[model samples]
Target: MRFSRAIATAVATAALAGSAAVCVPASAATPSTVAINAGGSAISASGTSYSADKGNIGGRTSTTTVASGTTDSALYQSVRYGMSGYSIPVTNGTYDVTLKMVENYWSAAGKRVFDVSAEGSAALSDLDPFQIAGGKNKAAQRTFTTTVKDGKLDLAFKADQDNASIAAILITPKTTATPAPAPAPAVGINAGGSAISASGTSYSADKGNIGGRTSTTTVASGTTDSALYQSVRYGMSGYSIPVTNGTYDVTLKMVENYWSAAGKRVFDVSAEGSAALSDLDPFQIAGGKNKAAQRTFTTTVKDGKLDLAFKADQDNASIAAILI
Candidate 1:
């Protein structure tokens, strides 16, 4: 997603030193629904127009593409780092606050530590975006429901070490209706390997006319099923699981057993010919090789079958197991 790193760093250093002033809104937007691209210019994402970096803070930009969860990589390419907090003017009422964070700078855990407080109470503590996200250039978010009494919705970033940072902030009025929980899937696959049981789920061994090569290796962490993760199918094209017409949650059980670093093994996942995951880095999302990482997506089976496709961006695409 690499830009002119040297130049961007120099420019950010200067602005971070206090050259950038707090920007006031132009009265063209609503205060209840607010989206801010923390350290970057104004951009639109998912039909929402996020304002330019506002409040009293500093920001830096990166060229790396944000992995998974969001299609708008630009929203997370820049970050408002080393900030004490932000004071955003908002309508007084109950609101859902969502903070979009990405570790574009640090790679290892504990390198950056911070806590965030909404209004005056703590909302997120001991936050390590890199650790929480598993790797850099990955998306991580925290949402909290809060009531804003004052004219402004105050946020404080208490830096425990290096500096506190944020990529974007979104505020929206809470809805009255609470959506029902997602229903679990009834299908599971071992993906090019033999079927085995783990974590109370019975995964069928390489189901749904699998077309890939299978291998075995040890998985480090993130699941109780080491056997499930140990067996993997690489260079697989896709899978077509037969099921009754209905919507279900599909979870891809994955681990990076070959590639040791991010970007080495990157790919995209498709469900029913629609993009499910883009630029999915197993090594990055799972934190490291042999570590368990899984992504759950909801899709509907219309043709009495669930069609899934995998396209590789870097090396060969792979997966350990599948839960449909």
Candidate 2:
């Protein structure tokens, strides 16, 4: 995921300045439904005129005609005009681009009606059309990732089909960043089980092993076994773990078990206990017939803590909780 390092730093500076943080408008395309002409710079159809409604982004519609033969390729022709072309100013960064083909139609006899390409020196050139079932409208999507120096982005699409219709094209920008590895917490084990805790006095959890198995080192507290009630609680019954105020993407891993639930387990998740956290609800697991489930959740940290809870709905299903 691409995150604005400058934005991250600015948020910290805002706290020192004792002022409301100014949000940087992340680079993105505003939502607007507009259609581009196909041939020149205007929408014109021969056997059938292309409707602007169909060409709007997210609502891809194309103009089509009822004609059969290798040479009957005259359906719609025009250069998409007046519609604004994207002139995105990008700095040195990685970006993800996606083109959504909302609507496409072709006759039973496969014929190449149109070709779409995103044009730029950084542009990728090989967007091959996958085989479509004959005689029906088809939809597909293409994606590309590229890095850019300071420059403007120019995306272009061209059509070559005889009686082809196009819906709308959509483009979005995403940042790419390398993540740092997490620091492993310390674990202390006794004859009963083990206890895991962080560097400071902020977070702690106690976990017990089943059948006298050696306890493993982990980050959070709580286990999937009903016989165990580890003490790795990050918050009180209704609070969440407090983090150092900053923007962060937090992830947690946990174990799931269905063996104790009389062969079936079901559960729902709830997050509470911290106000400094956002994006609380993480996951749900339904256990069935002696199966165990393990899963993780990712959330955005806004203030200082992240709190989470899981409630089972099975006869003996349970989950082990861990926080990163």
Candidate 3:
């Protein structure tokens, strides 16, 4: 959305440099008139349908006729005398498109002037009046490059002259590169030395140690490792953790590991506090020790806080928070 005139100028320069050869192919010889609508409705002939006889005034060696009645209804207001145009697909890069008009006939007292415009802006005008021998054909060439956004590129030409001809119209893509996308707002928890907080104020968490400890018999301390403490697990009573308010798709995975000698531990997992963890039921974890339980829940938080708890009838076995 940020428009930079300088960036557009740079793109135009690069495209012209790289596409010169492609635009003037040896096989391209003296510009020939291709079907004005060959590319699609996006490109067309404006005045008097592009005619090979219009003579190429632009540097482009190719030209086309728009036919007298083929003028676009929408662009009719922008055209006068005999005008026609062609459209080309413009990528998000820069481009340099040139059109050449040729004067076939001129009157001793009449002025022969031609103007060029992009979309509709008449920024390109004739350098001077085109002069041709009375009743004889003469050619003049003009070149100009403009930057276009990603989409269809429309070029229109109009002339105020008694008689004119077009030899060729040329459009070339000069260079292309992927533009970087915009950045998103930063959002995440912050850790300060030995102190963990949901706020992203600073970073100071203890380097080699876990900031907080949890009951090993239940959710062992250091069991979870994440920039956010939401990964840590707690016993069935479910423990509260701090979180910034925002829409979040919360995921919970429970792992119960109990050897035959450790006995079975029955447990259930749920979220609570700011939002009822039970409301996210289907996402509840239920099972016995040595078995893994998983649940996923999505909810919107407006109170900048998230509390999660787990309940278990235990004496020896326990469950660990696998992930959050």
Better of 2 and 3 by lDDT: 3
Off by more than 4 A, model 3: 1-81, 107-110, 127-129, 132-136, 160-165, 175-324
Candidate 1 lDDT, 121-196, residue by residue in tens: 9888877787666567778777888888776888888888688888889999886579766664578898767878
By TM-score, who's the top model here? 1
Per-candidate count of clashing residue pairs (backbone under 3 Å)? 3, 37, 54
Error of 1 at 190 (Å): 4.2
Alpha-carbon TM-score of each model against the true structure: 0.60, 0.29, 0.27
TM-score of 3: 0.27
Measured by TM-score, how close is model 1 to the native structure? 0.60
Off by over 4 Å in 2: 1-93, 97-171, 174-239, 246-250, 258-263, 272-303
TM-score of 2: 0.29
Looking at candidate 2, the ten consecutive residues that score lowest on lDDT are 278-287
Positional deviation of residue 69's Cα in model 3 after best superposition, in angstroms: 32
Please write out the lDDT profile of model 2 over residues 5-100, one tens digit for every residue: 888888888786654323443344332222323332333333333333323222222354533222313322212222223344444345565443
Candidate 1 vs 3: which has more TM-score: 1
Ranking by TM-score: 1, 2, 3
- Per-residue alpha-carbon lDDT of model 3 for 1-324, expressed as tens digits? 247888898899999988986777443332222222221233344442432222222332222242212134221112113436546554533455644333333322135555668756674664222221111222333455666653556667665543223444445555445765543233222212134433333333322212333332333323233333323233334434455666555554334433332224444445544432221111112223333333445555566555554544443212233222
